[model samples]
Target: MSAPITVHRPSPTGGRRVTVNGAIVGLAHDDRDLAEFLRRAGLFDAETILDDPRWVEWRGGRAHHYEAA
Candidate 1:
């Protein structure tokens, strides 16, 4: 199986960093940006990505501002 995707919010200005298998994919400014990045990378569909456990782990089980489109 592919390595799990990782989302990180390092700094308020740094935006969200998306990584897969230790490779940096993109730095997103918001939910839409993140979705776009994932779409472009063809890693996961928006719905699946939003529902992924990795997102919950990264966000401490809290809901983020981004929603699936």
Candidate 2:
């Protein structure tokens, strides 16, 4: 099965669209923002799982990337 969290590609202005369980969470400009989004989603250990493939899927570019190329 796919991960529950999905960090989409960066937009033209910056920041990536974050989703939890296929629902829109918010826009994250950096890793800190991503953590906060996850925290709000009830994942208290958001920071530690950012790099864990079982928790998140970084699309388009890569993890922590918030700039469109």
Candidate 3:
């Protein structure tokens, strides 16, 4: 199984950081950018990514969540 993707929002700056299996992938400005990064990394597909509840959680400003995409 793939490692769960962890999304973190750091203090002050309010930037989004994405990490897979403990390795930092990239910092995203928004959900769309995060999805695009995941797609390029072969973690998730375009069809179900945006519509998934996990993505919705992040968009809602949840600090952290484990997404096993």
Candidate 1 per-residue lDDT, tens place, 1-69, comes to: 443666665445556677766767787667677677777767557656665675423542233543222
TM-score of each: 0.62, 0.95, 0.57
lDDT of 3 by residue, 1-69 (tens): 432565665434556777755667787666676777788778667446544545433433553432322
Model 3 clashing-pair count? 0
Which sequence of candidate numbers ranks them by TM-score, best first?
Answer: 2, 1, 3
Q: How accurate locally is residue 22 in candidate 1, as Cα lDDT from 0 to 100?
A: 71
- Pairs clashing in candidate 1? none
Model 2 lDDT tens row, 1-69: 999999998998999999999999999999999999999999999999999999999998877889865
TM-score of candidate 3 against the unseen true structure: 0.57
- lDDT of candidates 1 onward, in order: 0.59, 0.94, 0.57
**C-alpha lDDT (0 to 100) for residue 19 of candidate 2:** 98
Clashes of 1: 0
**Against the true structure, what is every candidate's RMSD?**
5.3, 0.8, 6.9
